[model samples]
Target: MSTDLDYLQTVLPAPSARLAGKVVLVSGGGSSGPGWSIGKACCVTLARHGASVCVLDANLDAARDALCAVKALGAQGIALQADVADAAAMERAVQAVMSAYGRIDILQANAGIGKVGGPEDIALADWERIQKVNVDSLLIASRLILPIMSKQGHGSIITVSSVAGMRYLGYPHLAYNVTKAAIIHFARMIAQQYAEQGIRANTVVPGLIDTPRVRNTVAKMFSADDFEQAKAARDRQVPMGRMGTPWEVANAVAFLASDEAAYITGTELVVDGGLIGKYV
Candidate 1:
């Protein structure tokens, strides 16, 4: 018999060896709960397509779990523990990957936090924490990897920014909104600065994703005892009448990480299920 976990861990089919011989380092590369997560999906999807994936997360065990999926795809895998919010830890993580795999070809920055509150309701500490998790972490990863990529003269950086960053989408979390917005511009600037170095940087903006982390956060934000109610409310907000799946976002990450996007850089890929279209 198959369990939900079994279903969630199913390997995505390879689309050929597009990423063969490439090394991919994914930060926050694990699931937050017993279901598909954006980070895990990205790692697995990239691995399925032939990339050797390095799974880095604060939770070493979870990182290992995702590493298993990477290997299941007949891909090489490595697991590393790192607190992305800590600059020193991230630097060490970059070094560790370089030690294990001579060079990194793809950098996936996917770790983030979501807190619900507006300016008046948010506290200084909460705002700072959110910024560190959502914004500073991306900065740390990019700073550490830029020089390495420059020396190699080839690399792709795919960051997971939220659609909330582009505009408000029925959430009151000012900190999450502001920090996510920062991730977009930060990635774009990196793309522009590193274009001559044969490096590419882009942001994947996800909206109303149906992941465990998102479910719990929405429940808390609306004070809804019934998670279903909160979920349906989120569904209604999207023009497509439903929230997106992790696999959908993974597709975007894989495209950017692959050579298919060699000429694509400094652009925003909106995986919002038409939510942003409705907003516009």
Candidate 2:
């Protein structure tokens, strides 16, 4: 008997070279929690599609690992280290990309941090940190890329968000939720203002993905057996009866960044295995 994986692969279309010869900058393109993180998956998928990628991460090692993986796939990649929240640092990073690639065709602002806290118990410093990482970083990076993209008359900016921004997820991460919601609006506003300039911005809001971060967080939230049980239960809540992989999310991002999605802008593509549709 054929396995489910085999059946799925048979039904799903093969990957395409949609972004051939393009230059893409992927921020936070590193491993965060466990398994393949979304940023890492994006870097790999983009490279597989024939793009020369710049892997930017706060963790130098993680950035290097992502670049190495891309290179292993016979694609070109460079690892960059930068704190996305630092305006000057981000500007320099963009300048470096311009120097190396002549021009950037895609910008994936996927860096973010998740912290748990309620409105009454949330610490000021934690709140500030989450906001700075999640929202401020996107602002600074986009600000630096806007002029370059405007001059080129064509570019794509894809931001990673979460369904938590739209509805509750039985968690107390107020700051994370707020920043993610802001990102959706941010992308929409940028799309509206820059469509005339040929720059498109969109948000990829992933649902409960089976990334390392989610797994580790789940482990922390429940006992070992309970964690597994709860995870299975949560997965069953989705219409597909499973959590999505980072590669699935990356595939959506690649499409939005590629010319294939040229006419699509300021839209939120939720890749949640029907979780948002059922719950929200």
Candidate 3:
């Protein structure tokens, strides 16, 4: 009941049929805390555009919460809980989606985690954990879904990366940076390998997006006491002088998932507010 009903009610994009007759499976399709995470926004945005959505998250409550947004938009969708890094669990989630929708026209890998540290100091376990969740999960999901897409003779695979992947953001999260970089290449490879089969793959790179995850995790790294200060610091880092909203990223994902991007593949759509191109 304490959810961001205001944003959900008034701030969402106007509905359209840009993605009519498609099914989009979003991994980690839930909010990390309050408000809209990129994954949750993607679910809502895609649904608003007429794609039947499958909200898959490790947290059932979070998944259902996102599903509510999809359903509220008068869109069809199902929510399921699973660790995206777990092959068996993801397989089951795909099975459940298949049972309900019969086919998947798009796969969006949005599951990711980070531990702030450089190689000289980062724990080995932490390194492996980030890779497993961020990289391996994408691999597993794409591996399982590729054949289904191939059979359909068309599909879109979208990935979420960060400006961190392309360059340092004044942070030292080595594992996170590596995994994100790997994701871009992973999508590119899949794009080339599966182009003939009609499966298009691309990555979305966002910079300084203001979301719950940033307020909770990244903010703490900057200011242990005042999150507002942390937020301000991050905002100034963007050339646009402000952090982006989750809906902005969602719009990019929805575009990639739609036929409007039919001729696009093996590319990274940056939603970074000009942060990556800026020079200090």
Candidate 4:
């Protein structure tokens, strides 16, 4: 018998080749510290579903590590280091993927950063950094890739947002909240504008997911230094009595990236383990 923790750690293969022959580009496809970050899990999950993956991260080592996992699944993939928020770097990154895979069928704009402060308390620089990484990067990626996707006559753009975007999660991080909300609408706008061009756009909103980034940043905020306490507190907040895993979020991305979601567009997929639905 397997436990939930076992399930969370395991990376399951696709039930079908729903994404066969497709190419996927995932930004921020690396963990901030260790374990499976959401973007890394998306890269692996897309690869598992028969899509060639390109793992792009500012950290070269992390990107390479993710690519290794993709290749281990017997899927074609490449790793590159680029700042997703830098226009020139992102353009170059997109071109590199085109060169290696010929075309990009899916773009997972997953790069994001969070700071635990309200507008009044947060440093101006921190606010700008959060916006650039969490919001501007999505714009840059979409602006560059939309034309190519239009030419292909079909593509999928999955931007990662958060439950923080939807509502207050008992946090005072104004910048982070605003950026996350912005991406949700950004995807919807693209979804409508490019629908005729055969490009689909959607947002994946995850809540209280147990990832390295959260452990390093949010755990400290939640528990005032105790990791286990942070985890327990977050778990109790969720209606399901636990935080979600990156793999579960990746599963949602994989679905949106596949043809199975052909008619789905201009929407947000909330992967919060029922937290978003229950009243506090």
Candidate 5:
């Protein structure tokens, strides 16, 4: 039987099966477009490291696509459809995973949405949607998964936040910042509350990552009719002289989700290449 263990050993030449035998549930674990996304990349990386992953996304087709990618890479995976913003949908999704996998070891809450509006232009509805997607979904996923982890005596929970949570980078989005900040604080609190129960929680704060979902839309926000100009401007803001990639963010997540970070919790891992170093 060539398990994910065999695949990892032969394929990557890596020294360890970091997540061997673990089951990971990743919400938003699919690409919104044809390219790599933080969620999709994280899911694949976890699979590569020997984790059996459940790829959940609001889009069923995207979820299936991501699962197929994992399978193609010789990893175990399944597809699930859930709108993270919806409580019932998230609850049902969690139930589906429990029914299929019987237990959850790692969960990466990566579903989030950004609205392009400042305080004055922000609509109450859009703000609520952002809260539901970014903040509420995290809470819901934790509530549903923590119990199983608590019973099993161990688990890791990871939340994907943003550098915008700390500082604005000429972007005028109020809800995104607020919700992202909320995710970090909430994750810290969860970490403290569950640390005694053998459960760990952490947040990944990414800075200026070049991903398909946010680039063009953010370009519009910065009044860059030219997307390349937006990319260039963002590159200049990073100390590395370039914006980070989705894989970088995903790798951070993969590490956190693994036993490698067993003693780490309640902290924010900043994946920014010195953006906050200069600004904050």
Candidate 6:
């Protein structure tokens, strides 16, 4: 039988030149807890594929770290700090990108936070915070960039969503789920409204991603043995028998943002290791 490492090597597609000479912006392009997270992976992957990347995060230090990783790959990258929910800040970020690279070709809206709470128990403040960061931020950022992209005559916008928005994932985060669902719709609307303008918008949905955020959250929710057991059960649910890594999701984002996916828009690319296909 082939090992997991061998399977990954054989199954994963290598980076392509689909984004050659493009300028891409990745919000939340930084490590949130530990190791490389989805946003970080996307920044580096886009850079490796020949795009000059602008890594933006609320945490300047983390953004710099991600930019360094992209540079280490011998690709062009820059770090920018901005609150995704703030329109003026996002406009400033766009200006910086334009000054550095002349034009933007791709916009990856990936900033978000996860808090577990059901409707009855979730605080209004918490719900608002999640909505602002997860949904409003994407809206504002896209609003700022749409004109720039429209003037450029072409662009791609990719939003990162979660499987929770599509189906139950044994989590009780109502606000998070709602915000993600809204994001998918938002992308669809943008795709249709701007199709004639040469702009494409799509969503990349990831399921049970094995990132630091998931690890820490799971650790807080379950005992060590229970956590391991739960992870095993989650793996069993996936046809691929494992949770996907950040790089896996990053590859999907790269494709959706690149010219390779020019004919694709207003659709979802699920990178869930086949977990979303399982009924149970």
- Please give the CA lDDT of all the candidate structures: 0.86, 0.87, 0.90, 0.88, 0.85, 0.86
Name the top TM-score candidate.
3
For every candidate structure, what is the RMSD over all alpha carbons to the true structure, in angstroms?
2.3, 3.8, 1.7, 3.2, 3.9, 3.9
lDDT of 2 by residue, 161-208 (tens): 999989888768899999999999999999999999999999999998
RMSD of candidate 5 to the truth, in angstroms, is 3.9
Q: How many residue pairs clash in each candidate?
A: 0, 1, 0, 0, 0, 0
Candidate 1 structure quality by residue, lDDT tens digits, 55-78: 999999889888887776668989
Q: TM-scores across all candidates?
A: 0.93, 0.92, 0.96, 0.94, 0.91, 0.92
lDDT of 5 by residue, 145-243 (tens): 899999999999999999999898786979999999999999999999999999999999999887778765665557645667767877998999998
Tell me the TM-score of model 6. Answer: 0.92
Candidate 3 lands at a TM-score of 0.96
lDDT per residue, candidate 6, 123-154, as tens digits?
99999999999999987988889998999999
Ten consecutive residues with minimal summed lDDT in candidate 6?
1-10
List where candidate 2 sits over 4 angstroms from the true fold: 1-15
Candidate 5 shows a clash count of: 0
Runs in model 3 with CA error above 4 Å?
1-6, 218-225
Model 3 lDDT per residue over 81-165, tens place = 9998899999999999888988999999998999889989999999988999999998889878999999999999999999899
Predict model 2's lDDT versus the native: 0.87
lDDT, candidate 2, residue 223? 92
- Candidate 1 TM-score, C-alpha based: 0.93
Ten residues in sequence with the least summed lDDT for candidate 3: 1-10
lDDT for 73 in candidate 6 is: 61
> Which parts of model 4 have CA positions greater than 4 angstroms off?
1-9, 218-225
